[model samples]
Target chain A: MSVNTTQKKHKFNVIDAVILVVICAVVAAAAFLLGSRNAQSEQNSVTLEYIVEFRTIRDEFVDNINVGVKLVDASKKYSLGDVVAVTSKTATFIGTDFTSGQLVYGDYPDHSDVQITVRSNAVINDSGRYVIDGGYEMSVGATVYARMPDYTGTGYCTQIKEIKD
Target chain B: MSEKNSAAKASGKKLRLNIIDFLIIVVILGAVAGIALRFGVVEKVVTKSSLSSAYVSFLIQDIQDESANYFVAGDSFYSQTHSAEFGVLQSNIQFLPAEAYINNEVGELLKVYKEDRIDVRGVFLCEGIFTDEGFLLNGTSYIAPGSTVHVLSSTIDVTLTVTEIDAVGAES
Candidate 1:
């Protein structure tokens, strides 16, 4: 009787181990598949214009973000493309400083919204996500660090559009 | 007895699920969620709900006279930190000489206006939602009075303290 009880208990533990492994494997596989579904997906390359809106930049950098300047990805070191249009306005931000212990709202001093429209070739996916410069993915609100010939700034890819050809 | 011991050892060696295994799986899932949010995959997902309009006032201090010319009314600003509009500059902008407390000859700290510096105060018509945690810019960013924020515009970048907030549609 004792041996039977021991054997059943061992079987139960074996089942538990198998169940846990299957559950963990399923979870890890789902996450991996979902993220990489578009990593290497390439349907076609097209002219893509995306806007990178810099957060807090000085007036000098805004003015210098001129037409025809080339920009590259600061992190991945991939080609971002050339500047096609540059538009700027007043910049606003959720201030990081809370020393006053309250929420403060206001205009960012000496800075403005520098929206640089960069045109480059991107692989368009079926799901509308563009893979730019062969590696970096272009999606709305993706934070990008753009390094220009003479300047560099951090901003979000606020807009993306595929130019029909 | 020896045979039973061998059987038990065999079962143990075959990889039984332990408390540590459950913990490791939980940690892996949590890390995946953290990565998604950190990389901004679901950034716009959380911003779709709860948006409204409001007004924000800010007080900026210590600007040189020449630099103070940049704060203009009727200007609109966009938030760089979040995907939301910062606010529209109202005509209620004002600038005064910046005040500083300095030690006089008698060692008494006297508040006096600095001749070369000016302080700016202004109001903005903003589009956001007001919540118990102050105003949420585009329903994601937070703002409240007394916190210092670096206000960025197309023309200037400066730090300003939030002075007040008023929700436009709370009662409506």
Candidate 2:
């Protein structure tokens, strides 16, 4: 019986070895495919970055508030109405049409600086200081803008640091 | 019989190193990595919206106050011939305060202007009542009475007085 078993073992040759190798190769290939598919999907989705800053003012200046924020228009040329609608914020001048503001642009050189006006109905005085409802509300929705000494145009939200009174 | 027992032991070891085991490990690792990336596990996420009304209102006041000062220095142009001109001039005043007040007043005035109901433009006039110190009682130099200024809020109206001009209390 022992001799017969030894002969049978030796008879199991390269064919069996080749089968095992093929199984290992197939498993490795499947693993690689599944992993890569997941990786590709993740990379395809775009991630947007935004920052919101809060400026706390005293009761005296609380009746109204204004803060410069960034808006990223990934889709199209956002209008004032589009910015207001997508941002979920109310504007007192909703009835009017506007493109952008926070800083007014000019028509031509030597002309004059035009004042761009953005309106909101959310203004209210709390005790005395004006408060922004949410930093995200200001930063998200559209492309961002800056409050600078020069012309108003596109800008990014670099930080969310507080503006001390 | 002894040889067959030894062969079975060798086969058991080989099973431990099979492709199935390796595949299971790879799948687990891929799933973990995918979840982390999709949910931004390592990144900070912030959601933005709009500013509150109170902040916007204060900003308007500041803008109105500023425009009141600028109007004093700017050329005296009426709402007719200078309507387009003021739009350009107002655009130049980018201070948040100036923007807010101009936006509010312009919209209101435009509504009236378009309707042709409001003819005599209401300008903000200030009367500075001052005293011994800078702003003492009855010593009105900051604002001149009857001088046209923008009315900010119901409680606050930009008044121009006969007193001397003192730029000390001007809010930045």
Each candidate's number of clashing pairs is 25, 60
Q: Per-prediction DockQ, in order? A: 0.02, 0.03
Query: Comparing to the true complex, what docking class would candidate 2 get?
Result: incorrect
DockQ of candidate 1 against the true complex: 0.02
Q: Write the per-residue lDDT of candidate 1 for residues A1-165, one digit (tens) a residue.
A: 245434334333776677678777877997787656546443376888889988766564555466887776756667788899988886664433334544444555556888889898887666667877656888898988766643455789888888886
Error of 2 at B110 (Å): 16
Report how far off residue B17 is in candidate 1 (Å): 20
Best by DockQ: 2
Candidate 1 scores an fnat of: 0.01
Q: Give candidate 1's error at residue B97 in angstroms.
A: 0.9
Residue B32, candidate 2: C-alpha displacement in angstroms:
1.9
Superposition TM-score, candidate 1 onto the true structure: 0.40
Q: Which stretches of candidate 1 lie over 4 Å from their true place?
A: A1-165, B1-49, B80-84, B169-172
What TM-score goes with each of the models? 0.40, 0.20
Model 1, C-alpha of B163: deviation from truth (Å) = 1.0
